[model samples]
Target: MSGGGTSPDYVFAPHERPLLPGSPATPAHPTSRRFAYFAIGVFVGLTGGFGNAMVTTNLANIQGSLGLYSDQAAWLTAAYLMTNVSMSLLLVKFRQQFGLVTFARIFLPAYVLVTAAHLVAHSYTTALIVRGASGIAASALSTLCLLYIIQAMPAPWRLKGIVLGIGIPQLATPLARLLSSDLLERGQWTVLYVFELGLALISAALVMLLRLPPSERMKAFEPLDFLTFALYAPGVALLCGVLAQGRILWWTEAPWLGYAACAAIVLIAAALLIEHNRANPLLNTRWLASRDILRFALVATSVRILLSEQSYGAIGLLTALGVGNDQLIMLGLVMVLATIAGLAASAITIDPANLGRPIFWSVALIAVGAFIDSHATNLTRPQNMYFSQALIAFAAVFFMGPTLLIGILRALVKGPNHIVSFVALFSITQSIGGLAGTAFLGTFQVMREKFHSHSIVQSLTLADPQVAGRIQSLGGAYGKVLGDPSLRQAEGAALLSQQVTREANVLAFNDIFLLVTVLSLAVLVWIGIRQLRMYITGVNPMSEVLAAMARTRGQ
Candidate 1:
């Protein structure tokens, strides 16, 4: 029960007391309830991830169905991230001020309505509005999943639930890839939204039926918080716009990209300047700028960036070479299984005492996977990629739990105030890191493809006898249908040109693989060196933090 408005404090039984202002209490549940909570968590986690996952993995189909240009389709994704990223800054405080149950009651039903609206949203503008609303509403889903999982697990393993809950949403990507083909076959882009709406309805009903225990409320929102957000939200939205559209619009070719970048910098800088001086800031500027937090953000962002080897490298290569999602069902299954295994392995083997080790292995696995993929030829198929993609998928989920737990522990050791900062920092790293990875990798692939295309095209001329023979052989395939000699020759030349383009794309992808490999190895060495230095100096960075937590828990 909350105290009067003066104290902003509460008194409750230890078991019923919330760990934080916005979070639900950890009161023990009956066995059946725990099982129910676990099941709900799994479903909720998948539900949280699937909506955006479908849009991303099936963007091509959605683009065609909506008759949207590539730039326009990209905005669907940009809109989601734009609203999703900055909303966390407010959502955390909303729970603290209003209580999570009320937070859920409001957002969950709103999310369902927004998802249902997605079904009738045929126009691009309406779809964009729906996506923005979905982003704002769906921001609550991750918290719901984590809360449910925390309730499912007992106290000692409570941190384990946090890790699993954080990682569980990742399973949606592979699952979406596995299922999107069939969903697309069922209907148009709206069909995917139908599936999403169904999942949302299920999750919302579950949450309503099994509401979380009451949480303590506090007057957490400051008047300046809104002012800070006004500056921060637009800054982040602009950055998301640039990253989401830069590669589509071609960064240097678009003047607005430069303008957006400059505007984003100014806006973000102004917000940080305001927060840096505030006694009670929305974002903890000093804590986030600390050495340990900075390192945590870097390691977390680095792994997320490297994880793009699967999405941009393998999937992009396959798409370029005309491989369909239908053909990659088996590969998607492999990835789904690998991701589950990684989630289990990370949860099982997690040593809170040494969170960095799992991250090390994750980066190592990513390096090996990328190196193997670097050898890819035009002959590479989904089957050719099964093992490599599995490695990256496993690494992607594997790194998440430890990386998350590490920052979470550090925040807990500091104080409850820092938890908000850590959560916001973590969310930004993940959302922006993912967008940056796709944007950077896509840009790199495009540039490399042009170079390879130029080199390959320079060598092909009618003067070469082999070239002449291949063109004649290609043109012969059209001979039966075409009566004119010149037309047949022209068609054959066109086919040859297409083949050259495909080969160049393959080469470009291989370069991307190598690029990720190099980056992974570099991150590995950097982290390894720091780890070794800590060992040699007998200075474990997390030991004091963990001991502090252990002492707190013991009391």
Candidate 2:
């Protein structure tokens, strides 16, 4: 745990040695203090996640209030991600140099102020800025949540705290969907922001009341660091923008997407080129380009993509069937509980000897859940999806902890400098993977819907007996309301067409579900093959890193 031989330039204080090598000191607490720390850790973690969750879940309503178009409203989310994904690159260094107390003192108030600004800002531009700032604050809060949770636990159980801290945020989307109906019903959009502001104030108060122990400080920032950040931050932001808005604007149709994408490539390449030549690089490109790290990123990104089964496919299907958040409250509750269960299961059964096993099982569960959902019809409701969605939900939380631990162990073994690279790699893979998944699935859904619609329309000839009978039956209902025979017939035909469209949408969603099932199965097979090969070779990728982590934790 001594910061002696690995990196002589940076040293750890005695109290900080138990924590990450370059992290702030976290003193072990008594039992009562540990309980309090756990409570605050949960609160702050949920708060950080809930802020973005509320906004994302209620985007349509927020758009209506702001009088912005769908594409413009999407920018709000894009803005949040723009800063959120990029800030991790520098925030680690900020804490290393300035101390955790200083990091909290500045960012917590900024988060509160941004929440307030969101309430009062009537214009889209101002709101976008506020959201961007909130994203930066959120990244900081996530770090704080991990640190506080680590402090809450006894040494051996500390890794479990990390698992819970990371997994808790995944609950926000389901929690937001469950709570948003009541918030909107009681006080409209402003009420949601008010609730978020209250949480921020409480988090700020808790942090100030019981501060993290201070750590050794040094001049962690260098001129080259800012140079790399300046180039890299906006490059990632533009890439995020492209992913967020590509579907809305229709990829090939938007000219700016091409320009933005080109600019992003140039800027990111320039940043990496600068980092490559520096004596002390901000991002350790060599480590990131390693085979194991690349594989980890690929697996993580693939899982995120497959997770769109719940986020896009099932939800899109329900929305098409006239199900709303109000009707899905029970479903959300089921998912939240299932997620908590998964987190517990993962913590209890996490095997450092074989980290890939849980991930394998999680993907298998996703495939099962998606295959189950592929059988839905017009009669399908949120209640019908409870079990399948719960399986997916369980798998979602179950996989994340071990996936993260694998990377963390690897980074720890390498040295503290590689931590920044791992963080950046993780954030980009997750954020971009989500955006890519939604865009890909959504576009596929649209294309299938069109094809299905055309096929259904072609078969509905007036000459067919069943089609004629159905039209007549529909017209009969309108006969009592309309005196004109022709008008009633026209109305009935319109109704029949509407039904055809609805059925087409249902069929398209079924195709989407089947696609997810196939993709999940493919990923599972790939991972299984890799695991089998490793087993035959008698190689465990995590052994060295886990040994290193265990040694550090023991100190």
Candidate 3:
């Protein structure tokens, strides 16, 4: 089917298509042979998603042992997120030029190399850098698997296969978490990477054995607009920097940090202008001009970011309440239950075309759950924590299907850059939302800690006349709570202090949760306002521009 290629007919046309659908599909081979290849693709995609969690869980251990601080350690995540998003676009272009098999061949080895690099990284810098590189390769696994499935299956089964492809990887979360626990128990996190490296090799071997249809092969390749990337990089770096240090940066202030943020904004503004003017711009300015897409992007991005930051809050609260590593591992296990629940729900009502109402309702549930979590007064009970976490996870299942993504893509299919533009904007919004949530919530936590600590100290009676006189007589014995001559008296003071500190920590965490509750509520309010406006005016921010394009084409 490729016009310019000089390759032989057997190589290009492949004399025979597989017989997966039976009869016509089995003209050359049995139905089982075709299903087997699809099964292998599913396995590869599922493992890749699991590998994402494996790498993330181990990052803490790897950084801690290597003495990496927040500044250096931030890249471990930034690199992965950036490469994953950017590489999504890159894969689109590559698939246009080379076959899916060839791209898979290239990506799998790179992922394996990254896993290997993690195993041998001697210093913090090397490990951080290598982890970032590995993300690019690992991120491609799911997208490629989708493309493979879409090409292999006949039309009627393609949607079912796509749904299966996406669903399988999500199920990998619990398994990945399980592996993470085992790896952490053995000391260093590098072992997780070593395991993943072996897995990637197996994936690569499987790819070699799979047979796919020719039309699904990539059509052509295009070079990236480096100028656009140059602008995007600084924005990404600045945003990541803020998220990593925002707790210390003091929200929107803190001189140096604010300056970095300002610079990033300026750079992005310039990129927008440059791209809008260029004939073949990196971003599709015309599509962005659409009001609906803008609104959906903002709302979706906001919800995702808030949800992501909530993860940090949940983990922090767990630690504050003295949940041990083993307990946390158990908590993570509960999340798997959520994943299973999500899968089951998706199986029952998983239409990609009609996801808007479901997504809206899911966000509402998540907001309510966040409110419940905020008001949690008792941390001693595992049931309380489990209930809150499970609720959020259940809510997430409604929000995180390919339906919304498919909606957005269909909404923008008539735009100049199509998927590439959709992806770039999607990535940018997600990154920003995540950073804002994390930084805002983190700083809120720190400030709450300070405020609550002072409040608790003031509530104590340490300055009472009786206490003062006892301290004076003891000649600073209270300071040496453990080693004092009057051990009984010192122990009493120590106990009093511990009680005060415990109250203070609880109050601080409570305040932080309240702030999160308010934020989530605010998001709901914002969405409600926008939705009301759209409903009143019959203005769909998602499809307005796409609708215009359709009208123009018809005329």
**Number of the predicted model whose TM-score against the real structure is largest:** 1
Error of 1 at 52 (Å): 0.2
Instruction: Provide C-alpha RMSD values for all models, in order.
Output: 2.4, 3.5, 5.7
User: Mind giving the per-residue lDDT tens digits that candidate 1 earns over 113-176?
Assistant: 9999988898899999998988888788988988899899987888789889998888999999
Task: Assess each prediction's global lDDT (C-alpha) against the native.
Answer: 0.89, 0.86, 0.61
The candidate with the higher TM-score, 1 or 2, is 1
* Candidate 2, residue 220: how far the Cα is off, in Å: 1.7
Candidate 3: segments with Cα more than 4 A from true spot:
1-38, 50-52, 148-174, 215-224, 248-256, 463-502, 525-555
Candidate 2, residues 346-440, lDDT tens digits: the string is 88887877889999999999999999999999999999999999999999999998888888779888777778889999888788888788888
Candidates, ranked, lDDT = 1, 2, 3
Winning model by lDDT: 1
Better of 2 and 3 by lDDT: 2
